[model samples]
Target: MPHGKPGQAGSFTLGPASGDVNTAYRYRLTSGSFDSGWSAYKPGATATIAPVPPTSGTMVLFAEAKDNYAAGAANSVEFVVKEGDGPVARWNFAETSGAALDTSTTDQSLRDNAALAGGAVRTDRGRRGEVTVTRATETTPAVKSTDSGLKLNGTTDYAVTSGPVIDTRASYTVAAWVRMDVPTRNATVFGQKGVNRSPFYLGYEHTSKKWSFREVNTDAAVGTPFSYQRVESKRPAVPMVWTHLAGVFDAVNNTISLYVNGELQGTTPFTTAWAATGPLQIGRVHWSSVYSDYFPGVIDEAAVWQEALTDTQVAEESELIDAHAVPSVELVTAWTPAGAQGTTLRDTVSGYGSDLALSSGASLADDELVLNGTTGAGTTAGPVVDDSGSFTVTTQAVVDAAKILSKPDGYKAQILGQRTATGSSWSLWFEKTGTRQEPELDENGDRIVDENGNPRTTPVPVGRWHFGRLTADGTGASVESMEEALMDTETRLTGVYNARHRTIQLYLTSDQQASDGIAYTAQVGTGELAVGKGYLGSWANFLPGRLSDIRLWAGALSDSKQVSDVVGT
Candidate 1:
């Protein structure tokens, strides 16, 4: 008898011919031969094995053969398990030629069928597999100004129905892009009212040529007022040009920062405490139940962030917006030489000389003068000089004579002199008597004469000198001169004269009335008056020269030191 192994899934034959000796064969899926179990089939019979389910690990297959003989008589036959006769093992394509096999026959067959149908087999390898998906919420879409709000004929304006509210208790940064088809004239861009009924807002006025930030407090019956700050950019407001505007409010820090075209223009502090209000209004503000200061421009992409943006981020945003719009002005300019002196001191002839002399360290090439500290001891040379106490010029000849003053034209005169028995002590002097003074032509044009017809004469002290000063305090010309002496009996001089001349001049007694003996000629030099006055301030001399770097304030200097420091002689 012959026996076959189970589950081998292949045919086996075990029969002997009539002339051949009797033989038997057996086959089995032995543990060593077919560890992964197999099914057997009869000779000339077809059998199929179902596809194995996908498994993670490994698979193996084997088959065995044996010879059997009857009990009464011994029988033998050679038997063998051929390679194709055993169960077929599977493996991956990558491992098929190596240690493992492709056990997924169904997949392999499907790929083969696809290829036969003229389709390529695609293995989605190295791709991100199966990801969880999410859907976005519907945001309130913002309309571009160019699309909706910008098409109006002139001064088109719009308000946002829904936007983030600014909280006074917290800090915030607001930014926007704007292009005015017509000038804004004077209007507000953004604003909010505080709980204290105060109005704080940012606005631009074309007529005034200013961009202003106003914080108005309505606390007192008369409304106690204060100016937190205001700033104006150098560029003029131009039509059809986009400008970037930004404002940052840090209530806790009490600071307000303003930015134009991504650059910080100004910063100030909030003097009064901030009061709470809901949302800030954009494009308009209500004052006394009227919508005033309406913005007239195309405002697009307005944003309000809780945090202040860094300078780099602001610049990046500016660049991004500029790419889409034309800027109103050139961002930078090449260096060029100026035509005349950069600054002019108006009153160069006044005895109260500001240190407007040029310093050695200064240069026309760079157009800069270094002030403050320099090596020279007395009145270091510069374009400006401050004065201390009073300045005076005594001799009527110095005033009445033709003194070619070195000063900017169109300046006024101030003369300080005195008339007394012990030599005129000190008295304020001005151009009292002179013809052709209105259209003051030159240094030689001024003269002093007595209306008393006493032959304008010099007082008793011929050698005494008085003080006078010409000042250009960033305004029109002014002359200040005075002479004071506590002991002398004051003489009321009948005639005094001054001139607004371009060149400072020295005079001789011959230039005065023949009766006066006082000599007007420069004591130290031929054409220069020694600028020194004892007990008054530093004494020095200034000849006719260029004067520059002049400043004048409406109010007097804040401190005595400031005046002394500026006019250190």
Candidate 2:
């Protein structure tokens, strides 16, 4: 037996009608004691069972055939019925023959009038135009993905109806998965639009390349193309990509909102009283006006709800449409200073064995790891060799003059740096030289020449916290700093190096100061990654501040969104 929802009419077919051409068939159904007597015998044909009342459990249907040739055997099949509040009409286009099946009990099946124009061809769950029509006809385009969708020809293609299939007085949601075949022109994706009445329209405008929503109402001013309230997405929609577009009209909040890929794009006030009195049309505003704005794209999984959907519901439906829209990034490492002394700060993403060792003078205090500036106070780990050439390192540090982190460099050194100047290096410190305070720079903005002709650097102030980040890309190395004199104690710093984009970004959380797009040459080094103290003060010097929440990413966080996602915390 075929599957059906409760309160829906059941349909059954027994094909390969064999033997005598004059054969006849009889059908009956039974559920417990309730039974329908065998129907009068007739020519071999499929049966359209009457709509059964909402039911549960199982119903048995039997069929037997007979004719002037001979008597045929009997066969039976059982059907399981389910009860629920489902869609008014759901056309998955899974039918192989006949009109598109209405999967809902309400039986709002789309009226298929293929004979009036070019017929539609069905393949798998998708339907498309088999021939070009002189008159307007509905055309479903082929979708490249798994789920089937409908395609429109921008002009002279649309689905029209004599009456509205959906009615809404207060709240409603209309959503669909759409992909634009032509992005240079404006077009309507779906609506019940006529010259004067429409509940809503979800479409795109070529001028701004943005998804827009419009709900018909006479109260709105007449100067606009749409008399109803309108809201366009803040972010423009990209062409040729599958996007889930939805519009929610909420009378309770007097707001009409637009959403793309489940993210709320924009909301506008919609206080005018409204009702859709015209017929529904898909792909175009109407069949009579096919020359007007018509959608030129593939549309699928369209749904209309009488109630405004929540964000979570919209998100869930978007997932059912496509899961590849937002890609996931892999994290490399995460470290916190809240653990006990000598506890290992493990790498969260991969290679946990490369954990940092919490050692000497590095004591856990006030929920942070304090480095004594003298002796060995910090964490150390073996080398982290990355071939990707892209990396993001973030740390929250509380320092006072001493080195914050070092690779293998020795004494008289700044906070973060490699042994040689040619290697990727970074530093954050107060004093450049405690004993012999160096001048900051010469008149040419170059380091002052020392007695030996080597450039002499200046020393920053001491006794306060400072944030600094330095990154190297293909062009060169760039540095950003938040000086102690300008910021309060402690600060969060994020450094990102993206070789592909040839950009570096630094975020100073203390003041929310972001130094973005600092042109820098890219450099890929083979040195292992390390934290805190380098060579002894007799060598390089240990960090003299606290460090907390150290994290590393393998890929370049090239965008502001990626940067905010990481540094926001």
Candidate 3:
């Protein structure tokens, strides 16, 4: 840091003190409040950071030199500076209800700028979407800290500013963290709504199968046909995954460009430009004078700059937001056979000592947990579920249905469960319900009648596995499978609870579609989560079987197509 005099040029030059040919450097500017995050590491030449306005008039510069093997400690210096420009408009979407409060100082009256509509709402359940290469630790690239953002249902949900927020015809930039749920055609994430067509649309484009930042090259004229050209990202759009998108229009450069996760994608040379003087719309598109292509996901940390953002600044912005990505869906715990040891079933996902103790003479058969009907295999280690939120559980088990207690309908058993003493939260059950009585079938598929040639109305076991949910208020329901396994023929079961939709669904390997389930609307009950047993007042409803490879997730799996990949439908 040169510590240049006040009013001097604000650009700071960063140079490596010592380095090899492969050495690279990354730098950032911060004051105590606002930070410029970090820029992309560049090799060889020096890196320059122009004035990134801080809330205060001071800025702190930090630089780090790194090679393939090692990284140097960050060296920083402080500087007092003059004024600089900030975002023209910014929304954190931190509000739980009401409009998005514009935090930018563009104008004090524009504070309550964007209004929520069509059931669009704010949620603390925000940050990045659920997609990670593996279980993340503190040092991984995946974000650990959580953030808040806006949630939108695909049908009719959006947010619109009272007026236009940017100049479309001039050099400008827009950026946001988008988590798309559905790959709807031409779904718009953010743009300025125009009378004939939007000036810019940042969203997932179904035709190209990519996250795109598109700018309409022309607008519809009176009585003339409406036509326009645009630009889009090259990276494929990943549904239910969080990624940053930045659309840049450089009038001086005569081009429009887009960035995905801070990496610059392809650019398009453009000359035609128009001003669409309409309110800024989030999660929707207005094309051909029609309002549709509504976004089907979440948008957070949305912002717009009056000038085109440099590649370094865009990278910094992506890094800044990525650090706070919330992983809503994760494997909270996995109790596998490999983790079996003396007196315990270790959580394979975490580590040793974090295990479910084997008690009441519970034994292991080839590393699989073997428990008797009355002897439960419970855990005090993890209540793997957030009883009130979404969850998915899977287990490979061989059950002896003959050991299960009988009911008037038939035999019933609780395979896996987690609940409080007052009520049940969720459970996987094997139930035999009353099905219609029909004549017995012969080996040739013909009805086998008894005496007098009359068809006999014999009963059949309608036994099936199910996923059920019980609220603390005593309201509950289950989704039963269509498969029959009443005679010790069960091998595996999968259960899912989607808190957002308030449904408990079950899936079987033979089924091609997810089963329709009853509404599970209620608050989460308090208690420890366990395997191979259900709990009410005491340790009862124990499952007698070989249980292993138990996996648990904090969030529910998606539809049949997405979940089939996991549950192996």
Counted clashes in each candidate structure: 65, 20, 0
- For residues 36-99, write the lDDT of model 3, one tens digit per residue: 4444455556776665433234567767766566775568887765332557888878666788
Residues 1-569 of candidate 1 have per-residue lDDT tens digits of: 22222212333343333433332223233223323343333422333332221111222222222223331222332333221111122111122122222232446432211000111111111011111122223764322211111211223333432222455445556665554445545666666544333345665766666555555434222344444455554444433334566776656566677766566667777645454353355565555544456665444435555444444344444432222231111111011113325332123432223332233422223332222212111121211101111111222212212221222233222222211122112222223222222232336754445577433433221112222222223221222223321112222211111110111211111122123212221111111111111111221122111112222211121122322322221
- In candidate 1, clashing pairs total 65
RMSD of every candidate to native, in Å, equals 40.4, 24.8, 20.4
User: Which residues of candidate 3, in runs, are more than 4 Å off?
Assistant: 1-84, 128-146, 221-223, 321-569
Which segments of model 2 are wrong by more than 4 Å? 1-86, 96-101, 106-146, 194-197, 219-226, 286-291, 321-569
Q: What is the lDDT of residue 355 in candidate 1?
A: 33
**Cα lDDT, all candidates:** 0.32, 0.52, 0.66
| Candidate 3 backbone collisions, by pair | none
- The residue-level lDDT of candidate 2 at 168 comes to 54
Candidate 2 residue lDDT tens string, 1-569: 33554435567765325653434556666633224444433555544456352344577766666556665667788777654233444444444454444454443454321111123333322221111122223686433322244556676665554566566566777777665664657788767644554556788877777889877665233354445677887656654435667888877788888877666777888777466556556666532333356777666556666656655456555544222222222244666666544556555533233466666665666767676666544444322323223456677766554242322222222344322133333333333312225566867876677789877764433332222222222222444454432312566666665443345666666233345556544432323344565432123445666677776644445455545644565
